[model samples]
Target: MPTLLRLHTDRPGHGSGLRLAASGEIDLSNVDDLKSALADAVAEIGSSGEELVVDLAEVEYVDSAAINVLSAYADAIHRIVVHPYLLSTLRVSGVTELVTVDPVQQ
Candidate 1:
């Protein structure tokens, strides 16, 4: 059996940002979970002025379904930092402009 999809979220205090840490694969099998998580994150950020930061460092894979969900929103400024590997995939898919890609320090 495949490992279950897991997403961890952290919403800091006032003036702090929101962090969504995702692990495991996000394919057709578990894209919905990711979508739900993202939706909740968006809702939380929308209510508060806090930004969003998604850490995809442990995400082994992502498919079009996951990509489509992410493409729907225009995140707040300085929000949404995608992992380097995920950033490459997003760039190739032409959705890099939709989210901010933060470079990982070596």
Candidate 2:
């Protein structure tokens, strides 16, 4: 079965930060989309090198491949906002160490 993933990139409302909104499951089927979304978000910010914030609020599941995708953007991702339950997934995947994981009790 194919997982459905949706990615929307836009500038942050507060500042020049890039925001990538990811919805749906993040598995092997859609991990590449996540990566492309982040990359596109960064590119949209030009040469600012400011920051990329991934909003994982609507995300339901994240697999190992998805974690690896996030790991690759560790340097560019400033913060990852996720559901409280997803905190364990990020920590276990070692993504918390690379980037900031802000768990929002949703």
Candidate 3:
């Protein structure tokens, strides 16, 4: 079975900042992909104090398992941008307390 989540990573030319754009549905079945992507991003950023910008504006859904993955990398993540509807879930899951969560501007 294929995972429903898709992750895209981008590194800026000159800083410790990196961006990861995720789309599709995130659930337990495919949570590993999210973890792997974050892990790779962290490795790339190395000891430079990686600050990640997660663009989840196109993400339609995310389950608890996916939230856990994001939390695991909270220290490395600078912010997470998601569709407005997903805000509550991330907040209720305590992700908002760990990192910045913003709604994508129209």
Give the number of the best model, judged by TM-score. 2
Q: What tens-digit string does per-residue lDDT give for candidate 3 at 25-91?
A: 9988888988999899888777877688989999999988989899999988889999999999999
lDDT per model vs. reference: 0.73, 0.86, 0.89
- Candidate 1: deviation at residue 46, Å? 2.5
Q: Each model's number of backbone clashes?
A: 0, 0, 0
Q: lDDT tens digits, residues 11-79, model 2?
A: 656776878898889999878788788778767776786777899988899999989889988888889
lDDT agreement of model 1 with the native: 0.73
Could you give me the TM-score of model 2 versus the true structure?
0.90
Model 2, CA-based lDDT: 0.86
What residue runs in model 1 are displaced by over 4 Å at the alpha carbon?
1-3, 12-14, 76-78
Task: Name every residue pair that clashes in candidate 2.
Answer: none
lDDT top scorer? 3
lDDT of 1 by residue, 1-106 (tens): 5446789898656667888888888888888887888788888878666777776777878888877767765454344456577777888876668767665554
Q: Which ten residues in a row have the lowest lDDT in candidate 3?
A: 9-18
CA-only RMSD, every prediction = 2.4, 1.5, 1.7
| Model 3 misplaced regions, further than 4 Å | 1-3, 12-16
